[model samples]
Target: MLRDEKQYIESLRDGRVVYYRGDKVKDVTTHRALRAAVNHASLVYKWQADDDKRGLTVYKDPENGDVSSFFKIPRSSDDLIERFNLIYQTTRFGRGTFNIIKAIGSDAIFALMLVTRRIDSATGSKYAERVTRFYKNVIKNDPAIAVAQTDVKGDRLLRPSEQPDPDMYVRIVERRKDGIVVRGAKAHTTQGPVSNEIIVLPTRAMTEKDADYAVAFAVQANAPGLKMISKPERAAEAAMNDEWFVTGKENVETESITIFDDVFVPWDRVFLAGEWQFAGSLAVMFPTYHRFTAISYRAGIADMFIGLGKLLAEYNGVDDKSHIRRDVVELIKYKEMLRSTAISSAMMADLDTETGIVIPNKVLTNVGKLIANESYMDVVKHLVDIAGGLAATLPASSDFNNPEEKVYLEKYLIGKKGTNAVERARIISTVKEIISSFGALYTAAMLHAEGSIEASVLELYRSYDYKDSKKLAMYASGISEKL
Candidate 1:
């Protein structure tokens, strides 16, 4: 695929209806709230054209024999491994900045490819053909895309059909001769404002009565009647890690409450329509692939935490301490755990053999994500612990740059005997920015990005191979003669 970074930026000037901070943003590419994410996305596109990652980022699509980014349907274990490598390599460029968030849209399409085929088998619908066409269009166009999988359900305990406010969940209100009209809202949609396209999917299982809600479609991000709202980054967030941090102005991840006010979707673009039974299929399948992406990209996150933690330890002159060394070791173990699980998930991937779609090993994908969610807080805790109070009480970057304040601040803040004040302050400043700027946002994202922690646990319980465990236990206790 051609990586048209400049074109991608210029295309954002289109009148995408985006509301942020009580006002409509004129242009997301230049808007303070979304510019960072735009640039972050640009890097991914740029990497596709750059010469640095020759075989890693660029690959020939085995199916079509065209060279493109590895974000495509994996036809085999090799393809899955390639996807993992590309994601890991790209992610390490930023601390999960242009991470799973951008690429999962394609994964959604791959999920849809398999699910629609299943639907075709069950109901004889030609939705799978439409999805295949859409996939081709996506690969050819090379557009930046975002996926909205979560709906703004009014009542947390109720299903979409049970909601008093039917519009709380995205649903088709009118099935026109030309297409369908949908109205509802999706909250916490990442990269909502600036993407070239938005792929919408049903959030959960649906019954026959919920057919209207069981719809999947793609629309132009600047489509009429579609609105996106994003919150502003804190001043502290942008001030630190200007280039690498997603919370920074030049590289941020955006989440918004996206509203579909009677947005019309043409029939050709509709991947799922009134297919209630298969709603859960898309819901399950999409996340399975997405979490695999999450697990792979998290390797980069672990690397960041490890590097920073070790640096903070060395800067603090506590590198020799037993506890500090132990913490660093813990960070390394966690990093390898994430990376190894991701690799295994790819290596042990499953195939919808006939469809040529490679699905991730559900157990490993979910387990990896679950472990990452569980341990993320502790990993950050170790980082914070090693950094000491300096991470908190550090002076602002502006103060350090000030001619008058530089000498006094730097002289007092020199961390170790050998390290200069500037070097010590610089290290602490970096730690300070990353932890403080994007701390809460990154924390919340790590907790619930792919899905909630409880949801991951449930998926693991439901998909895990428990038969072997049960048989082993039964034989050991003499509960059964043979497993």
Candidate 2:
């Protein structure tokens, strides 16, 4: 049941409660503030429906007909590598922005599928069956999903149950015969307002006392008591229309602070309830797949940066300069380093024997993500250097349009011989957009999104085989022989 863009757009008119700029959005699909993001999200469906892109975006399932490749669980390294290519190509299609509408949702589903199976095997619970049913429905309906995991913690030092305000973390406030009621808010929920569903997961490990917080479930985006307060789009309304890179809404992303004001989740939709022990496992498993997605998409974005830098050099008539060539090489190194790590992570995939799901190498995935997180600003720096002061000083497009100002801008803004002012301005505008306020939001996301830099560092340290490294060091130093 592959959905097209029209169906995906029509699904969002479901009376979801969404607020933006202090006003209740009448319809997210049409609201000025959110429509661009909605359109951006619709590309996931558009790609699936396009004849040329169909093969890359979806696969024909013998049992289910056409299913999104995102929903296909990776069974081997080849499957994982294919998934990487799908993400990379799609990110490039979006003009360097990764669509989270499906990528993130599928990440959560995969983690849920793997973790539930383990829990059910150990406890004889029916969680695995429930998750399977939910997953089947997801593939059948092809709904866009938004994952809400990061709680708006009130105090950093305190645990969930120890918080002065108990509702700081999403928790099961009441258990009913048919379902559970959840109350809390998750911050930085990407594309929540436009998504068809929201999947919730525990943010951290829990204890017996924190059992209530160890809850995971899915609810419709327009479910009763659910609310999404979206952050304003980073690009100004004027800029969206004026900037070459920002025009057409091709490269936009949105985030929301999703609120679950006692939202109800049916038992079938509840994957984890009061299972404090397994909460950490699910929390960790999600990032394992998501960071791999992150690095893959970042590689695509790095490719864009590399191209932008070369264009800047060519336009500046410095393409032959040794320093310019060196900078371009550095950008290539950054791009391929991330791309190669993603490939290695997939090639060194780990198989969950019980579930037959291929998991990306945890250490390599984290290492790649950490590199992306730490080095993104440097990528920006290199491009900014190549683009020159014109990247920042270029006049607004409106000024360029004015008859009085057009002549001066045209005569003064010309680049290398044979290149017109407009072309040079467009390239500089793109570089400016990448380092502008909009690009700042993207920069902050690189540091914080998909878990923080420290989170990846911790995961890499934890997943690495320290004992083996210690043994090798001991043998090299003759300590092993002494023993």
TM-score of each: 0.95, 0.97
Clashes of each: 5, 0
lDDT of each: 0.82, 0.89
Q: What is candidate 2's lDDT per residue for 61-109, written digit by digit as tens?
A: 8899999998988999999999999999998998788888999999999
Q: Show pairs that collide, candidate 2.
A: none
Candidate 2 TM-score, C-alpha based: 0.97
- Tally clashes: model 1: 5
RMSD of each: 2.0, 1.5
Task: State candidate 1's TM-score.
Answer: 0.95
Q: Give the candidate number with the greatest lDDT.
A: 2
